[model samples]
Target: MNITVHRPGDLTSADRAAWTALQSKAHLNGSPDLANPFLSPEFALATGQWRRGVRIAVAYEGGEPAAFFPFQRSATGVGRAIGLGVSDCQGLVHGPGFAWDARQLLRACGLVVWEFDHLVGGQGPFETGASGSFPSPVMDIDQGYDAYLGHLRERSPKFTRTTLAKDRRLARDHGAVRYVHDERDPEVLAILMGWKSAQYRRTGRSDRFAHPWISQLVRRLFHTRSDSFAGILSVLYVADVPVAAHFGLRSERVLACWFPAYDPAFSRYSPGLVLHLRMAEA
Candidate 1:
């Protein structure tokens, strides 16, 4: 096996194809953490805006691409997983039964310590170092919308009742309720950014919207579509205007939920929570 390091923004079309091929073979799941979007070439390119230390490690065996590691080198000779804070999964994307020396890769990338928080299970080289587990609640939406709602009712009776009542009240007082499940509307993305920014400010949190690159990345990702990490944007509408919206990634069966926000005008009605219920049904 041979390994080579490529500087940020140096990957060619062929390198991208090889990386994508390796990712496809890994059979990524929808947790947004393990899915390929954050690990995709496009994402790495965008992440260069925030993290200027990005690099790609491509390993080849018999002249065929076997594994691809997307990582960032810090000033302290440490390598952190790419998209460290924002990405749900942090690990190597590789072909079946692929194996490599983690220390060697780190050294090649000029790093001493490699750290990752959300490393996916079954990452051959780094699996042993994963220290803890993080719980991500998921609702299966495979059996059609009604069936999912039934599952929700059975699993979370109180939550279901309260949310349904809220929905009813929202419709009665505000206007008729309308939902645009899996809506690809750009307006919804804009609305979500506005609400998310407001939430950050009202709560005294750092505003992600204050960063131009982060904002640009979100907007760019909202429009990106590919097999590995296609953006799935869904919205809940009232009188033809989006009141609630969600942005996530759909990789196979898993739908990794990311940003979700609702119109503050409808906050009393809890439109955001209502939108989640509808999303689980979709």
Candidate 2:
């Protein structure tokens, strides 16, 4: 096998095709937490100008594409998995029989240390190279939505009952219960941003909303579609008023949950939790 490093924006069409093909075959190989659209050549190119230290490494075996690694390098001779904080899954996308050295790959990428958190299990190259684990909760939205809610009720009985009761009371007083599944509404994104920003301020945390790229990336991703991931925006309403919203990505088998927020005025309704339950149902 031969390895080659390509700048983030320099992946060719052939490389893109090969990378995506491997992604399809190894659906469960990487982290399951967050979807990295950065793995997409088009998305890489689209956000290249704003993404510092981005790089791609493509590996070939017998002159055939075998694996792809996306990473970012910092000035301190260290590299990190690209989209680290947001991507639930992190690691190289590779073919089944491919063999490569993770240390060599990082060295070739011009880094002394390569760090990753939330790495998907079975990343052979990084298996022995320093790693740890953490819990990431996932709802199986596959058995259709109802079955998923049933599981949630079993696992989180108190949370489920409380959220459901709040939702029922909200509907009774508000006069109607309405929900928009997979809503492609830009307005919903705006509301989520506002709530998220306020939450950050109230908690005395640095606001991600201050970064325009973060906001733009979320909006851009909401409209992006591919076999590996689908941009899904959903909103819940009470009496025609928007109360809760969530934005996320779903591959056929996994939903990468992201930003979620609800109108503070409806905090008594616990709309955000209810929206997730409804989403799990759908």
Candidate 3:
């Protein structure tokens, strides 16, 4: 296999189309997680706008695209997934049955260590490099919202009751609640970032939004709209005031929840949970 590295923006229309096709095929026939918008070429393109080191390694066989690896690198030879901090899915999107040596790929990309947290399943090339593994929660909502809710209620009746009761009380006390699945307002997006930043500080976690690049990247991603990759900014409002909001990436098959936050003033109401439930129901 011949490997060629290029900036994400350098990809030609044909290259981008092939990458999307390969990802879609893999999502249908291999791991369902490949359907995540974070794994799409569009996402890499958007991230590349704000990130300097974003590159795509395309492996070719017989002068045709075989696989695509999108990542960002540091001057110290360290590599990470493109949009690492905010991206929920990681790893290369390849054609079916395609395989390559992980170390070979890393060397080809001039990286000594490639770090990834949410590596998708069915990756054999990188299995040996994995030091530990943990389950990433995924909700199977293929059965529609009501069916999934019933399944949840069956599994955790008390939890479901409490969550629903809180949602009802929230709505009652703060006027009727409204949920916008794909909110386009830029101000709401800013509000989400602010809330997320405040939540990070409150929990004593490193605030990702503190970085100007991350903030710029998210704002650019909000305007990215396509069939395969679109920014989904969902907001929950009470009495016409935004109480909770979530900014996530979505494809036709999967909604990969990314950043979520709520007003601390409504902590007792669990507005975050209500927002997520409404997102699922929508």
Candidate 4:
């Protein structure tokens, strides 16, 4: 096996295609989380453009690409998952039956330590490196939205009734309520960021958008659209006004729930929950 390192933004079109192919193939191995959009080359590239040190290590066997490791390197030879702290999914993406030593890959990339959080499944080699692990909540709607709602209603009938009643009240008080699953408006994204930032400050937590690169990266990603990866901005509107919004990334199989916020004036309507339910239904 041979390994080569390249800046995420510098990867050629061929490289991007191969990377996407490997991830898609990996999804076939019963690890659908491998299909998360955050693991896609486009995400790495968008993040690389706004932040320094983003790199992808491509490993080849028999002159064919086999695996991809995307990370951000520190000055002291430490590595972290690309778009760390924000990316909900992380880990190397590899084709079936491809194997390589983690240490060797690290050395090839000139890193002494490679750290990851929320690492997706199918990473047997890195399992020993983990000191702790936790379950990542994922909404499984493979059986269809109707089945999911049925299950939700069965499990949380009270919660479901409350949420539905609030949705009705929201519509009654503020005109018809509607949901947009894939909103393409850039202005809506800006509004979501502002709401998220305010929510952060209100909770005494530091705002993620306060960092210029994170903000720019998000703005740039909003424009990125592809078959395997896309920026999804879902909004809940009442009387043509957005009461809640969520910006997330989507791949073929997975919809990563990222930033979610709502207009505080509509808190009684539980707009955020309504937006999530509508997003899931869509």
Candidate 5:
């Protein structure tokens, strides 16, 4: 096996195609998380454009791309999953039968160790290194909204009904409700960043948006439109006023839920939940 490392910006067209194909093959092996846009080549390219340390490692067997591992390499020989903080799901993309040792891959890229917090399932190499694992909830809408609603109703009837009631109340009290699944307005995205920053500050947490790169990454991503990775800004407005928003990335199939915030004044109305439900419906 040959382990080749390329800065995401340096990847050629054929290299990108190989990387993308690996992502698809990995996703089809019975796991939905592998299909996430955050794991797509477009996302790596976008991130590499904004961040300098991003790299993609493609392992080849007999001159065919068999696996792809994306990470950020620090000068100190340490590496972390690409877009570690912002990427909701993270992992190596590989063919169904390909096998590569994580330590060997790290060495080829001149890294001592690689770390991950949100590593997706099917990552065999880092499983032993995982100190703890937690479930990240996903709302599967492929079967359609009504089917998802049925599952929710069966699992948690009260929460499902309450969320639905909030949606109804929001529409009744505030004029017509408008749900935009993909809002192209830059202004809307800016407002969402501001709201999320305020949320962080009010909660006595370090505001991630305070970092210029994080903010810029979000802005650029909002403008990115592609099949593998497109920024999805789901908005909920009542009476023509913005109440809640969630900015996430989506591939053809999965939505990698990301930064979600709502107007504090509308907290009682639970516009956040309302936005998500409407988003899922869309």
Candidate 6:
């Protein structure tokens, strides 16, 4: 067994494929949603380009890449899960049976300590670092949109009906409804950024967009187009004007919902909910 560390941008083209395959095993061997966008080589690549100290440790067993651990390291030896706040799931992408000493692995990465929140279960080495865990709400569309909606219909009939009715009313009252998934127009994304900032201030929360780095990261990610990971900017339009929108990261099969906001002028119609529903279907 061996561990090879490299800056994200230094990764060879072949390393990306191996890392992606290892990530795939994480999904197929367990929950499909384990295939998080943040774990994709694309995320690491983007972050490496945007910031310094981004490192990835590729563990090879029997001369083959077996696992991947990506993190950002401080000069003082503190390490954090890559893309921490924006990443929904965090972990070393490994085969189901893979296990290693957490401290040893951290040391291999030249880290004295490692920290992570939202670390996925089934990770053996990092178990000792976990103080506690919390449940995060996630929509499981593994059964496809219709099947999941069927479950929603049975579970919350009124809620589902009301949301759908509002969707219809929104379309009728406005003009034709146009839900664009994977929208690439930078102007539309700028609008989403504005709406999100206003909402954060209105709700008395710290606006993340206020930070230049955070804003820059999103802008950099917006241009990322890869087979395993890409930015998904979805917009809900009424009468050809943008109403609600969400920007997220997705692999071919999994989507990590990130920035989601809507025009408050249309708040009465609950455009955010409507946009989410459309995103799920797409």
Candidate 6 similarity to native, TM-score: 0.95
Q: Give per-residue CA lDDT, model 2, range 170-198, as digits (tens).
A: 98988798888778778878888898889
Off by over 4 Å in 3: none
Cα deviation at 254, candidate 3, in Å, is 1.0
- Looking at model 4, the pairs that clash are none
Model 4: residue 25 alpha-carbon error in angstroms: 3.2
Q: Model 2 scores what on Cα lDDT?
A: 0.74
TM-score of each: 0.84, 0.87, 0.95, 0.97, 0.96, 0.95
lDDT at 87, model 5:
78
Candidate 1 CA-lDDT value = 0.75
- Per-residue error (Å), model 4, residue 251: 0.9
Model 1: worst 10 consecutive residues (lDDT sum): 27-36
- Candidate with top lDDT is 4
- How do the residues 1-282 of candidate 1 rate in per-residue lDDT, one tens digit apiece? 788888757877887887765555454432233444566666776676566788888888998777778888878888888877677766777766676788887787788988898777666577667677677566766678788888888988998899999999988887878887666778778878888899889889898888776777777777777666667888887877788888876554456777888878889988989988877766
- Taken over the whole model, the C-alpha lDDT of each candidate is 0.75, 0.74, 0.88, 0.89, 0.84, 0.85
Q: 41-98, model 5: which lDDT tens digit per residue? A: 8888778877778999888888988777888999998998888788777878777777
lDDT of 3: 0.88
The number of clashing residue pairs in each candidate reads 2, 4, 0, 0, 0, 0
Candidate 1 vs candidate 5, lDDT winner: 5
> Which regions of candidate 6 deviate over 4 angstroms?
31-33
Which candidate number maximizes TM-score? Answer: 4
Report the lDDT tens digits of candidate 4 across residue range 106-163. Answer: 9999999988888887788888898888998777889999999899999999999999
